[model samples]
Target: MTIKEQYVAAKQAYANWGIDVDAALETLKKVPISIHCWQGDDIGGFEVNKSELSGGIDITGNYPGKATTPEELRMDLEKALSLIPGKHRVNLHAIYAETNGEAVERDQLEPKHFENWLNWAKENGLGLDFNPTLFSHEKAADGLTLSHPNEEIREFWINHCIASRKIGEYFGRELGNPCLTNIWIPDGYKDIPSDRLTPRKRLKESLDRIFTAEVDETCNWDAVESKVFGIGSESYVVGSHEFYLGYALKNNKICLVDTGHYHPTETVSNKISSMLLYSDKLALHVSRPVRWDSDHVVILDDELREIALEIVRNDALNQVIIGLDFFDASINRVAAWTIGTRNMIKALLYALLVPNDHLKELQEKGDFTERLALMEEFKTYPFGAIWDYYCEKMNVPVKERWLTLVKEYEHDVLAKR
Candidate 1:
């Protein structure tokens, strides 16, 4: 049967469970996932310094044809977006700012530095999300930023974050969508630190100073991200989950949950409901972690499905900002972006297709047998059929067909680089 015929059969199957396949597709299309730009350039931004990645973050492989210029990066991103279905936003690091061949310090950055990006986003009908580049700089060489002991260094990073917020606000004001500005620092020690409270205290103070200047909430929102541990911070991390959760709650800011930023066994899916209880909204940096914080390309795994289910089941789809965060330079950069994003969307689609209310009612009524059986039955549902229908409707390649476009681009465009 044709794709549409298969979708009709799947829709009829879901209708037996009182689930509307059309409504699920519409809801999935409306949710926007912010695609990270760093995946295309291996986290190497357009800055003139071009220093190696530092501050506990590392990209493992060295695939050829990584975008080296602002124009090239945007072109690659445009290609990746074409293969992925759904409306999406682009997440930008402060280091990606285009300065027109001038040396611009991070603290001295302005919205003008990203005017090119703003124009590009506007043209593409995409919203922009911003991040302060707190790592891979001279000041962050010690693997400490925003919580650095040196007053001068801390002040410098603080100013940079403040400037980043303004730039984010500018993007939101221009694009008519609120920009989420997230702060993630790699401040920790390789070995045990005598005093952990001091760094956190300093971090709090610095964040307070950076937030002192009020920007319109309609334009920009602030978020803090926590890390379990990093490459050089195995012993102790300053911005632990506990620290940022308290800070975000006290300050009424959004807390970002990165899937790869937790312990091997810990999952961010469980934390979504708890975070939604207090905060009006939250952000997510979805990536796959094999055993640790490896930032591998995301796939449609069990944890990913659970994360999507929690967001949908709790009725927090509108309240949570979904974003991709992974840099795998070992494979085709464009293909990596396309694969990870398509998987993210697929997870959400699968969650939307589930009869969440049916399972919830079964559990609440203490019908463990039915609930277990129904859950297992859903595993065999024609989810892929509905996914193909959605992709076809969105005018994107279905299944592995997107790989054809990626291969063509690799030969024609990436090979020239």
Candidate 2:
């Protein structure tokens, strides 16, 4: 059957469950997933005086044809965006700043260094998000940044985060959208610590100082991310989930959750509803973790669907800031992005096609049998057909056709690099 014919049949099937496939597609189109720029270059941002990847952060797989310059990274991102079915935002780290060959310190980074990025974003009609890079720097060599014992080291990172918020506000003001400036520090002890309270206290004080900076809250929203541990800091991580959760609640900041930041058994999907109850807004870093926090590419797995379901069923689409956070240099960097991002959208589409109200009613009424049967049955429904039709409608390649485009780009543009 033709694409339209398949879509019509699928739409009718969903209609039987009181689902509106067209409406779901429309909603999906409007939702913007913040694509991380670090994926293009494997988290290797263009800094003049760049330090090696530290703070337990590591990127494996030496894929050829990686983006080496800021222009090239932006170009690769544009190429990937062409294949994805919806409009999206670009997430950038502080190290991605363009300083015209000058060794600009992290604390001194300004919006002027990102003029080209702003112009490019304006031309492409994409919103921008910011992150304060705290992992790979000399000041953080001891695997502690804001939580460091020394006053000067903590002060430098505080200034860097404050500067990052200003850049975030600048992007939001120019792009006509609020920018999410998320702060994730890799501060912890490799072994057991004699006193954990002191480091956490220092970290809390640094955060208070950073947020005290005068900036338009409407333009730039602040977020604090917590990690269980990292390569170096395995025994104890200062910015644990409880630490940031309380800080965010008290400071009225967004608590950014990374999928791979928790224990292996713990899931971010299960936490979304609870978090939403306490905070007016939340941010997500959707990543795939295999056993450890490996930062694998996202897939359309059970957890991903549950994550999407929580966002859709709760009507928190606008309240939750969705961002991708995986960097797999083993595969084609562009294709890795295309696969992960497309799967995230696919998961959302699958969730939208669910008979959520009925399922909830079944759970509430204690009708487990029917709920299980229906949920299992819907897994085999005409989800792919609806997705393909949406892709066609959005003017992107349908199904595996996009892979051919990626190969061509690899052969032409990337191969030359």
Candidate 3:
């Protein structure tokens, strides 16, 4: 069938199934796009070249060296950003100020590296997805202990945040842009029972510091919207994230949702919906699924592809930032990164084309089972259709369309077989 015919067939099939096809496709088109650094190590020579899938590797380890030489990082980032397709960029890494042979510091990233990075991003016609402070596994394993949460850890966290603020100044004044910062708290309870209020209090105090800087100094968006990081595999107790969200909203800070951080038992769609319901001010840290690890893979699963698209389409939250949280070693292929990113974009377009009315109806009447059923049914309809639609929308040539179709068909067959 022709591409248009295929879209029509898919639409008609959905209609036959009592779902609104047009509304589903329409919702898929409105999401924003971004670039992330999942493959930095590959480019940096830490990982073997053959294992590198993308041009770079993820700075996933506790290497204090990553942030020490800001100039080296800037050159590498410039090279990577030159490869991206758009004008906006976002990156997440655990960087420190220590030199090449220095011992890794827990929270020792020099704020200047971030400033240089932001400056580079601005110069390169890209925006920033600046995840200023990330956590290490050691910290995750051994939760940060504070004798007086209000006095000690709070101060340390604030100092780190101030460093981030100093970087924000460059974005606001020098770059004429804003940096997107996400605070993913790795400080959860260890084996022992801890006072939830203390950690929460510490988080709030730290956030207050960041926001105070944001409000007082620079005009970057990151300052005003304190991105609250919550509930990693190790950090949060059962209700810690929910409480954090409540607290952040109460204090005018935004909840930054990382796709892979939640427990396997939690429904991501529900969590996203809940966050959106509270306030439109939000940020997203996107990645793939994992049982224990926060595998920063480009989202490719059919189900998750749809959910990610929906998050962008349902832009109730005015500020939506797309993040590729994948961090692999250097031996991986750059082609894989391109394909994964393209697939994500394709899925988003498909979601946008989906009829919003169908989602609304399903949401209105769907119980748990019905909702799952609806999501499953409505998922692929738009993704496939939109993929085809976008090629045409972009004015792809007929020959290119045929080649793409052949590849997609081959992929689908292999996936099924």
- Of 1 and 3, the candidate ranking higher by lDDT: 1
What value does the lDDT take at residue 84 in candidate 2? 98
lDDT of 3 by residue, 248-290 (tens): 6787666666665566655455666666777656666556656
Candidate closer to the true structure by lDDT (higher is better), 1 or 2: 2
Q: Which candidate tops lDDT?
A: 2
lDDT of 1 by residue, 248-270 (tens): 99999999999999999898999
If ranked by lDDT, best first, what sequence of candidates would result? 2, 1, 3
What is the number of backbone collisions in each predicted candidate, taken in the order shown?
0, 1, 40
Q: Can you write out model 2's per-residue Cα lDDT over 1-417, one digit (the tens) per residue?
A: 999999999899999989988899999999999999999998889899999999888899988899999999999999999999999999999999999899999999999988899999999989999999998899999898998889998889999999999999999998889999999999999999899999899999999999999999889999999999878888999999999999999999999999999999999999999999999999999999998889999999999999999999998998999999999988999999999999999999999999999999999999999999999999999999999999999999999999999999999999999
Per-model C-alpha lDDT, please? 0.94, 0.94, 0.49
